[model samples]
Target: MTERQALVVRGGWEGHHPVEATDEFVPHLKEHGYTIRIEDSPAVYADGAYMETVDLIVQCVTMSTIERDELAGLIAAVENGTGLAGWHGGIADSYRSSSDYLHLIGGQFACHPGKAPAERKGEQADNFVPYRVEMLPAAAEHPITQGIGDFDLVTEQYWVLADDYVDVLATTTQAVREWDPWHRPVTSPAIWTRQWGRGRVFVCTPGHDMDVVRDRNVTTIIERGMLWASR
Candidate 1:
């Protein structure tokens, strides 16, 4: 049998440490006997034909622009049957100019008012508040989050615009801080999965830095998500 193939596309804003994030996970995929091809640019999306042959795509891109042709190619490839996975802005907040891309990913990054590094000077980071991730009761038994319970961490909590149809696996409650208003605590999706045609889409909102991405639970969840989504 042919070894499972995976494509890792990395680039865009350096603030999120896209390269580091990709580095941390590629080894796990290799351990599972995956043939990995790493792309350092978003231009790889333009190769519709090349994309179709792969089984999974791990994208790590921040805010960037994709040409019309490249965007179309990517769409066709994913819809045809390509598992897509990524954490934080690398996959979620990337290509803001293309609403179609957001629609494909099932969510878009709006704001991360948590603790951001000085590198992301453009982003407004107040206190990188400590918070807990609560697994949704309905999805607690799912493979990706099964046997996983609540955990606390201090990191940038992402406020994303997510689709209602997504199967949300975990969530975090917004804190009522002195700096911000919205006194009513809001529950936001921390990790979720969706189906696009024959493809599976997985999104995790936790990785604001390398440390968070390296967290054992975070890595386990993303690794499982990638394996579960592969064709």
Candidate 2:
């Protein structure tokens, strides 16, 4: 078998704790026989030669500005068959200036309407909230979630606006509650998979913090998902 490699691009908005979180996840990939390379800046991604030698790219960057060439190289690498995978705002809300980047990934982070209560300040809304994630039939059979069951989490239940081309792996139904004024019933995808050229992409929206990702179910599911998404 050919050797496998993984490049983990971290370091963006410190609020998301990219360094800490990616540090915790690196061991899991290392144990899976992947040679992991960690970068604290986006410069590494701009280097075309560096980006081309990898089998997979695991991004943990959130709300940061990336240069035009750097962003283009990352997208081209993925479109040319380098697997890409990430979770939460890191991948979904990253590079707001780049429309092509969002197009390549198949989803964008919309506002978290459920947490927008007038009484609670900005701090409260971004804090952890309890919710349940429902596994879709298709995801239940997929390798990433095969043994995973419906689980409760206290993390941010992301309400993303997904593209139609994505195959939703799981969903979290955001229910209207007294604390939240919006009473519209809707289902938001928690996990999804999409194909870009010969590459595969898997995204999970449950990892708001390192503590949330430490959950056995979440860790296992993400580890499996990384392996499944890697080329």
Candidate 3:
């Protein structure tokens, strides 16, 4: 069989360590018969011809901006059967300026609520909380999540604003602590898949750093998601 193509688009916030994070997955892609092409910017999305030849896109960009045409090309590529997959803010929180991009991914990072004032310093790490990622019953049989039981992690638990278009597989719940403003607990999609035209889009929200991404459960889910979403 001809080797499949995978485009790794990585950049944006240094905190996410896009390069190191994406590099860890390169060997996996290669072992699965993919010829990898790595780009440091979302600009590669604008290459319509190259994007068309790609079977999978693994994006690690976080909180970055995308040009109108670049976003358009990405949407077109996925809509035309190219797989799009990412974890954490890489895909879920990327390209905040484009509503169309948000529509394509079907989820956005609202915030990761931190510890109470007295218990925390002013650091991003304050947002790292212990949370359980529960696999939803509806997705228990889904290929990407099958055989994986719910697991716990102490990481940046994201609060996402997602749409109904995504088929949610797993979720994390944020409690209604006294310091928090919300009256009730909030549950966000921890793992989800979106079917866009001929393509598949997958997102997992636990990968805040290398350690989190390396978690056994997270690693397995992401690996499965990449293949499951690929054309």
Candidate 4:
């Protein structure tokens, strides 16, 4: 079989465990005949030639910054037919300062509200609320989400700000809990895909950590998404 090239660009906040998260899929990428090049920073994105040659990019950087040229190069690669796939804050919450990056991904991490004040213990884990990922009707036929039923997860349920460019596959709703100020439940796209130029972009909002990424449902969706998004 012919070999394909994949790039794993990871690094940012340690809380998301970028290394471990991406590691979970590296072996899978290899099994599928992909030669992988792993980078710890976005600097590699500045190399337009290398970026154009990459068939896929699995990014896991969260709450980080990207330089102007780096962001431009990354965008150009995707627009030129390089697939981009990532989950949780790694892709959705990454590059908060770069609006162009947000436009490329088609979604932004707004917040993940925690349990009620009375239930909190002054820890970040408070945001790990029980939630369900509801697959949309159309997703029943989408390759990335097909055969994946609605599932429950007790993790960071991201409230995303998404645009019309995305094709949402699955969604999660945040209820109006006692502590939450919203009057009604808010629904956010938990899994989505975007087509930019000749490239494909896939984002899954449930991968807050390794365990979450390892969830059977999440794993299947991510694996299929990576392949489906590839050029």
**Local distance difference test values of all predictions, in order:** 0.83, 0.82, 0.94, 0.94
Candidate 1 lDDT by residue in tens digits, 184-215:
77777889998988888888888888778888
Clash totals in order: 2, 0, 0, 0
Clashing residue pairs, backbone N/CA/C < 3 A, model 3: none
Decide which is better by TM-score, 2 or 4: 4
Question: On a 0 to 1 TM-score scale, where does candidate 3 land against the true structure?
Answer: 0.98
In candidate 2, residue 191 scores what lDDT? 87
Judged by whole-model lDDT over C-alpha atoms, candidate 3 comes out at 0.94
Residue runs of model 3 more than 4 Å from their true location after superposition: none
Q: Over the stretch 126-184, how does candidate 2's per-residue lDDT look in tens digits?
A: 55668888998897689989978899998677778877999898888877777765778
TM-score of 1: 0.91
Q: All candidates' TM-scores?
A: 0.91, 0.91, 0.98, 0.98
**What is residue 1's positional error in candidate 3, in angstroms?**
4.3
**Which segments of candidate 1 are over 4 A away from where they belong?**
115-127
**Taking the tens digit of each residue's C-alpha lDDT, what string does model 4 give over 1-231?**
679999999999989999999999999899998999999999999999899889999999998899999999999999999999999988999999988999999999999998888888988788899999999998999999988899999999999999988999999998897766789999999999999999999999999988899999999999999999999
Residue 48 Cα positional deviation in candidate 1, in Å, after optimal superposition: 2.1
